[model samples]
Target: MRQVKHLLADKGSVVHSVSPAAPVIDAIRMMAEHHVGALIVMDGQRLAGIVSERDYARKVVLKGRSSSATPIAEIMTTEVVTVSPEDSVDHCMRLCTERRVRHLPVVDADRVGGVLSIGDLVKAVISEQTEQIEQLQRYIAG
Candidate 1:
């Protein structure tokens, strides 16, 4: 099974984050500009929470909350699920499904490595399956 490290290697460990004190509008802007669904809320290099487009749509829009006035801390999901570099891709796939989370911040040795989206896990799984299928075909052909 492939590991989170493998995915990160292909995707290039890049984590886009915002301060917890930043406005919801800023977070939204960052997400839009970066073409991401979520942002890791940081409190001076520490993971504070995660703010997603869903959070914005549900918490701020539905609730009629002011995006410019609201802080990320207000709507961010605090109890974030995290993964490590060495963790298996299979585990991450399970976590995303069971936890109903779209993004997981990758942490390694007390440092933030990157963020893994559900897409990344799915791609990794597909790639691994393809490799296995190719190997099987090669053996049968021999």
Candidate 2:
């Protein structure tokens, strides 16, 4: 099984974040610009919360809240569950399934390292399985 650190190697450990004081609109723009589904809310160097597309839709749009006027902290998910680079890909999938979250921020020793989405986990698992399958096929053929 592959580790989260290996998966993160291809995708650099750069976390896209916004200040808690930033407006929700700012977060939306950042998400759009980066083509990501979520953004970490940062208070100085500390992780405050995470704002996602679902949060915007459910908290802001559905509630008839204005993005420009509303602070991201108001709609962001505060109690975020994160994963470490040492964790396995299976652990990542389990956390995502159990927590009902698509994205997991990778924290390394109190610092935000990177973010892993469901898609990333899926891709890694598929790649690993493919390699194993190829090895099995070679053994069977030989």
Candidate 3:
């Protein structure tokens, strides 16, 4: 059972964030600069919400909201679901599946430690599967 901690080991604890008061355009720019799909919206020390490309498309573009004038907080999903470092990859996958969300912030003691995406879980699962297959092949040859 691979945990989020294990999967993020090589990636390190890097949580990309922005202020809730920031313009939606700023959030979009940051996401583009980082090449990430989402950004954690922070209100001081608290996790206020999350902004993503999808949010921009649905709320800003489709709804005719101005990205430059609109605050990220206005479009961000406030009911942010989270994961823990010790949480299993399977648990995160299930959460993503049920919530239809792609990203989850890893939290500890109400502090954001890192972020995990569906891609990260998929990569970890694929790596584990490949290792198991190699082990089985070796055993069969022996």
Q: How many clashes does each candidate structure show, in the order listed? A: 0, 0, 0
lDDT of 2 by residue, 1-83 (tens): 98889989987888999998899999999999999999999999898989999999999999999999999989999999899
Q: What is the per-residue lDDT of model 1 for residues 1-142, given as tens digits with 9 covering 90 to 100? A: 9888888999998899999989999999999999999999989978999999999999999999999999999999999999999999999989999999999999988788999999888888888899999999999999
Every model's TM-score = 0.97, 0.98, 0.98
Clashing pairs in 1: none
Worst 10 residues of 1 by lDDT: 119-128
Candidate 1 vs candidate 2: the TM-score winner is 2
Off by over 4 Å in 3: none
lDDT for residue 74 in candidate 1, whole number 0-100: 94
Whole-model lDDT values for every prediction = 0.94, 0.94, 0.93
lDDT of 3 by residue, 1-142 (tens): 8998887786778889999889999999999999999999999999998999999999999998899999998999999999999999999999999999999999989999999989999888898899999999999999
TM-score of model 2 vs. true structure: 0.98
Count clashing residue pairs in model 3.
Answer: 0
Models, CA RMSD each? 0.8, 0.6, 0.7
What's model 2's overall lDDT?
Answer: 0.94
